[model samples]
Target: MGIAELRAESKTASESTAALLRELVAHLGENRTQLREEWIRRITEGRLLTAMSKDEIFAEATSVYDSYVEALETRTLEALQAYAQNLSERIIPRGVETHEVVGIVLLLRDVLARSLFSKYHADSRLLNAVLDAYEPAANAIAITVAVGFVRERERIIRQQQEAIRELSTPVLQVRERLLILPIIGLIDPLRARQLTEQLLRGVRANRAKLVVIDITGVAAMDATVANHLVLTVEAARLLGARVIVTGLSPEIAQTLVNIGVDLGKMNTVGDLQGGIEEAERLLGYKVVPIAEPMPA
Candidate 1:
């Protein structure tokens, strides 16, 4: 064939494909409820969407079907992407997994393709063209949905980690010129580093003259943890804050000595109450009991 004839044939094929896409979209729109029902049945029967109610399943299925049809008709992927983002946000909080989200998209694609093939069985050229457009669009939709789910999950994980760090190391200003850091749980290297940073910040912020580190909640200690504690104390001392170690259980105390850690240069107290008293005494204050009132 001549170049012009080949160009003419390609144009005709392109136009024919567009027309078939429009027709397919129209058919899907007309049978929207039926399509959604079939999609939902397949998903529910497969136990893929187990946590969602019937209403929720139907609603999600309808939205997905509508978005797919819109994208196929308009020849744009933005509609599907927007729909995926919205769907991901809605379903993520409902405990839907990423795999389930992608599975639903793939299932809908299969159902729609089956419907199209059944309707246009005799038109081989049109069927081929439709498949060419539909398969890529389906894959794109699945990818976009998966991306949205993963992004949201990662954001949630980061938020949770931040919360955990805050809870693990809490600094409190118990009184004027006095701060307390009540350590709880295991103090890994990362948490120890975080604790050091927090202690320094708190000391500067409160202009604290004394810091009492109470480790009553700590179940055990290791050599590395003991070193972290020593480093934190040293850092606080450099900032001109006197640090008093408190809540040293016999086991932990033995651990410190067995590891050849000499806390003798630092002030040590038996408990939080003793630490508070020592802090008050260093600040030149003394607590005294009041006398009882005489009976009238």
Candidate 2:
């Protein structure tokens, strides 16, 4: 065919596809009750959405069914995408897994497909055309819901992780003129920055003469993190608090050396107990042992 002929043919096929989808959408709407009930039955049998009560499942299933039909009628996914994300937010905290979310959607697709087949089955050509129109939309709808759900889950996880990082980085006042900051786990650049801020605030607030930073739980550090550690020590010094670093792992010590960190300027100790003793010595406190009494 000539280019103009081919272009005209393509437009005609596109129009036909849209028309078929419209007809299929109307049939689904007319049979919405039976089809949605069938979908819910299958979901129950599959043990999907088990975290939810039957009433909760029915309410959510109704919303999802309506949204799915609406997306078909509109031929766009923006509304459906928003609804899926909202649904995910509501249900994820109820312990819904990704497989469960995806499973229910596929069940819905199957329920609707069987309905379409039953309605359009008398004429083979007509049935084929309707199926052709329905398959692409169904696949796209599934993908939209799946992607939205995953993105929302990732967002929640990141938010929780941020909260945990803030909670874990607290600088604690141990006694008069003494503070201890025990850092553990992995430290990103952002967390390293937080360490400096927390240390500075604690030293000033406590008017601490000595601060012990025990990094026994930390396994290693990169050059950037080593620099951040050095900066945190200097910030405490500028605030008139002498900093003692204990639990210097071999790997972290090498990272500091590689970063050109001058260990001579930083007071180092072997363990938390040794660092506390050294801090007490600098504050002119006598180390006297008092044994605990036995229980009567």
Candidate 3:
């Protein structure tokens, strides 16, 4: 037989031996009483048919007893060898169903002789069924692991995104009703465009009355960035939101002043607190302590 056949035979032998052992264990319960009884019945029936002389009868009975003993011993040896092989290979020898044993036996039979591939393709149906039984359990485990990983990844990504957003700009809260967006990163055309959309949406949704854009964080700006800022301010105005320019460092202030950027139409403040106080003044509210005056 080919190597494949030999291997197949070996597996079949292992499986069969295991199955036989299970059957034998069940059969031999009660101190082998069942086996003993069956043997006794067979022997008794055979002895009754011996109607020959005493010597002939004695010889015939002895021969039958010896044959039975030898057969039992041979079977015992084969079973012991099968058990040992199974232990070495880590095969669970007991509790196997008939269908499993049948499958293994079929495989073993195929291995004993070499033939064309089409003549005896190993029937995959049995193995397939076994795999099918395990599919749902395996898939459940895989999905659980995948979902856990995805949740963990999403959490990590959200944390990182929050950090980036925070570092992108300094938020100036105004009177608990308005916010001044002071962008720090480069206000290139793309960023300016995105900021415009965000601010407009925020102002309308929040019903903001004022937005003081502090430009001190801006390191440098080209004409395009400058023009985008102008357009952003105009859009906020159209949405019924007032705009204040603040945090104008000396250098930027000088540049805007020299460039003749129009400041006559815009309200400007020097710092964030100053801007908020100005907005609160315009709204006719004063933040003061509610305590009686003390006299010495």
Top candidate when judged by TM-score against the true structure = 1
| Backbone clash numbers for all candidates listed | 0, 0, 0
lDDT tens per residue, model 2, 1-296: 22233234335658888888788878888888888889989999999999999999999999999999988787767788899999999999999999999999999999888887788789889999888878777888898899899999999999998788878877888778899999999988999987888788888888887899999999998888989899888888887888999999999999888888887768899999999998876666323335332111
lDDT of 1 by residue, 1-296 (tens): 22233234335556666676677779889988888889889999778878899988888888888887876677666666677777777877888887788788888888988988887789988788778756655566666667767887788878889789988878999898899999998878888888899999999999988999999999788889887888788889889888999998887888888887766656789999999998887776323335332211
RMSD list, candidates in order: 8.3, 8.8, 25.2
**All models: lDDT?**
0.80, 0.85, 0.50
Clashing pairs in 3: none
- Candidate 3: which stretches are off by over 4 Å? 1-173, 254-260, 285-296
Q: Which candidate leads the pack in lDDT?
A: 2
Error of 1 at 55 (Å): 2.1
For residues 9-67, write the lDDT of model 3, one tens digit per residue: 33555554445333423323332343344443443444432224545434433433333
- The positional error of residue 258 in candidate 3, measured at the CA in angstroms, is 5.5
Candidate 2 vs candidate 3: the TM-score winner is 2
Q: What pairs collide in candidate 1?
A: none
Error of 2 at 260 (Å): 8.3
lDDT for model 2: 0.85
For model 2, the superposed segments whose C-alpha errors exceed 4 Å read 1-13, 173-179, 185-211, 216-228, 235-242, 246-263, 268-296
